[model samples]
Target: MTNRKIYRIALEVEAFPGMPTTAAKLLPLLENHDSTASEIESILKYDPGLTANILKLTNSAYFGIPTRISSVRQAIVLLGWKRLLQVVMTICMSPLMNKTIPGYDLPRGALWQHSVAVSVAAEILVNALKIPDADEVFTAALLHDVGKLILGGFVKEDLQQIESMVTKGITFDVAESMVLGTNHAEIGGQILGKWCFPAELVSAVQWHHDPESCDESCNLSDIVHVANTMGIMTGFGKIDQELALEHFGPVADRLGLAPENLEDMAQQTADRVKKLMVSWA
Candidate 1:
């Protein structure tokens, strides 16, 4: 019964409408090193609302631009295409993520805030660790809990059984899997796969809660795991005040982070997330 139910919920990911058209188009472009600013402007111009939000975010204090950015092309020029793509992705994701999530106990905008926080945390980790190949980390971190959107209803239905397991000293995600046959991390990977994301990114989300289980994308998974924990530790994106469930030591060691490095990263992530949320709110 649990397996069948999990299969049904997994199938629902195909119908999830949260990935905006602009985002879908832009995501592929982010991978193309040859993608030009005009190319980005072309896709965004059709979605004026997204363009406007992109401009607003580009001009936000987070980017530290000295001049005002009034146009997409101009913004792209000033912020560079890669940074502009990240901003566009953030704007495109906000509407769906801002909605209140049921089972996770996230209020309207809370999940979005937490996602942004995690994304920021991921960026900080990549820079601090100087992992040059981690360009996909931000997107992976942003969508790590996307499974919650699909699984929330099911979780609500099984809340009592899942909560019972949690009370027995099991972590929430583990309890979720035991009671529901799958957890959000696995479902989140399914969602990303349905969206045609890169394999590494899919792996990163799939094993974010269990980095040790991810072989090929272990480093990426480890970064996202620690980033999600940092988001929770900074007091954003908590599932009903649930503590950071993943152990910090092993993942930190894999990432070559000492305790003091984590403290510094946490402070930087919190400051950056707070500033970014100003425009996001």
Candidate 2:
């Protein structure tokens, strides 16, 4: 894969060299039952800014709690441990996702919007279809475009060429390769692998833009691909001209989504998503 343009682009990024060490320090705490809420709270207490940010988001208009939740402990109790962990992971990666990348035409928070929307879409899809491990699916969908973080500076420099090709009706992945000699999929997978995300998730991001390539072995990645394709269709993160509809055709077939039912489901998902957009947006 080293010679592949996408993989080559990942190689150009200055990835974290001490990620495993940091993971070793923290993973055991999350993995072992010994780490309690108090322990995690104690760690957060020192970082007042972090704690405040978390609390703010928990009580934000997006979450739509009946009453205000003013503390991390209360937020944890209300949101639950699983959701809390997700929030932590989101916060930890904010620096990377929020970084400016002019090449991709992404503003400071553009990637974050896309990431979070895809995550919510994945969860919604999994729940509707009764897909297992929905949280993991949500996590993978959230980070699917993580490669953009690594390729930020590079993409900013060469986006004109990429945009030109995209305007000419070239596929997004093709445009990325043409402009940067790499694409987001390879870049995202490497970052997640280095950070010890589950292998399946890494694979989902690496292959989401191309589900057929992933179906040779299994359908896990295909699930994510469809979720993302739905997001694309619904214009979650962009307002561009018509996107290629072919990306969803075969996957919908595999998933057995009847053509007649699609429009209604899309509307339902959009309505569900709107409720939280006030706070999140």
Candidate 3:
């Protein structure tokens, strides 16, 4: 629980391979209004496997595109640049995410399923609440818990102490910090920062488990926090901590979400995740 230990963990995160090369290159381009579809195509063309997966997702029932998408260009045009970026990131990150995390007790594919569910739930909240400034919300929710990948081994080493704190009524993440001096949410933010994601996106991952710590001007963290809770409620993610619905009241009120809204969102999230996972799997 020393700074040296945390420093070593930070070194490991930096050493971890970041996003796929092509996907990394295309992220900023897509975020820019001046960038062209052809530019995106140019980068993706080299990664035939990624291009094929993108096309596959576009044609998948989850997207609901009426026409077949044979090429990246066609998919880009139909899904628009932003949606295309989401699909590209999803496909690009799936391999890394679809793994077991011993620290959190997430089995192979469990983390991916939870990540996808949270992403879906985040968008559902956005539209339901009629919030307009959260274009990065989906990706933020998807990659929210990515820090588990790095911290799993360390967590397993200290699981006993962590669990003891949890039994005493401290939240799991808080226990992680008390025992490890760093929790998955904070490390996840570091991972995103290494990937060069925007500050808001990084904060969303950092403060997801403790939205109260997030800057008040940004609600992306609050959105992801609720979505993560919803993901656990739907039984998609690992749940090491006791969940208290009332704990979310303040964030819910800020988002204009009623208690009933969370229930409705949980149901809708489950249904959407079910269909998407069927096709995605």
Model 1, 1-281: lDDT tens digits are: 36789778967876887568888888787678688877887887788888878888888888889999898778867887568767877887777778888987888888888888889999998998888788888889998888898888898898888888777888888888888888899998988888888899999999988787888867788889988878877778774433445567888887888767777788888988888978766
Q: Rank by TM-score, descending?
A: 3, 1, 2
Clashing pairs in 1: none
**Which parts of model 1 are misplaced by more than 4 Å?**
1-4, 239-246
Report the number of the highest-TM-score candidate: 3
lDDT by residue (131-238, candidate 3, tens digit) is: 888999999999998998998888898899998988898888889889889988999999999998889999999988888878754599989989998998889876
**Cand. 2 Cα-lDDT:** 0.65
Ranking by lDDT: 3, 1, 2
TM per candidate comes to: 0.94, 0.78, 0.95
Whichever of 1 and 2 has more TM-score, that candidate is 1
Model 3 steric clash total? 0
State each model's C-alpha RMSD to the native: 1.7, 4.0, 1.6
Score residue 23 of candidate 2 by CA lDDT. Answer: 25
lDDT of each: 0.82, 0.65, 0.86
Where does candidate 2 have its weakest 10-residue lDDT segment? 18-27
Kindly indicate the candidate among 1 and 3 with the higher TM-score.
3
The candidate that wins on lDDT is 3
Cand. 1 TM to true fold: 0.94
